[model samples]
Target: MDLAQVKKLMLRHDGCVALKANTWSESTFTALQPLPVEQRGAYCVLKTVELVYLLCSVHPLPI
Candidate 1:
């Protein structure tokens, strides 16, 4: 996902556009660092991975 798409998904989670509360916090700072500088969209891509691991449910919710 692009940065815009990542931000859009984040809107569903507490309206958090960025990964962390403070600029210098760990996750926020990590997301700012691309896995590889030459890799295209690596920043957003990294965020996408984190979002999946952190937010995605492991089991189906009962309705």
Candidate 2:
């Protein structure tokens, strides 16, 4: 999606957006890197993928 769509989606989803980076997919960073700072909304990079994998691997919660 284009930047406008991405921004709108994020706003619609309560400003919670998760961007994933891996060997297989186009990196979200690369796509947004060229945009001027003003166009880029607030965001943070987190270890969400690792944390999710770890959580699932251990099955910490009762299913």
Candidate 3:
């Protein structure tokens, strides 16, 4: 899958999910299945001893 495929799929889903609870746990995660390796997003849910979540998209960035 490519960004075009991802963006196409997002069009089916409402572009974003409602930010329910604003928290993540041992069970909650976002998994875009049946996708090719290229269309995947980056994740950094853990940083050493801390848990960090972002409301950001990674297809493009200043970095």
Alpha-carbon TM-score of each model against the true structure: 0.30, 0.27, 0.27
How well is each residue in 1-63 modelled by candidate 2, as lDDT tens digits? 144544565577687745455432344467557868865554213333443343345332121
In angstroms, give how far residue 34 of model 1 lies from its true place.
7.6
> How big is the positional error of residue 37 in model 1, measured in Å on the Cα after superposition?
4.0
Assess each prediction's global lDDT (C-alpha) against the native.
0.52, 0.45, 0.38
Order the candidates by lDDT, highest first — what do you get?
1, 2, 3
Determine which window of 10 residues in candidate 1 has minimal summed lDDT: 54-63
Q: Residue 7 deviation, candidate 2, in Å?
A: 22
Off by over 4 Å in 3: 17-63
Question: Per-residue lDDT tens digits of candidate 1, residues 1-63?
Answer: 255544556686666544435433456557567656675476667655765544444531121
Residue 35 shift from truth in candidate 2, angstroms:
0.3
Better of 1 and 3 by lDDT: 1
- Per-residue lDDT tens digits for candidate 3, residues 1-63, read 245644554566678434345334323344435445565443332421132113233432121
lDDT of 1: 0.52
* Residue 48's lDDT in candidate 3: 12
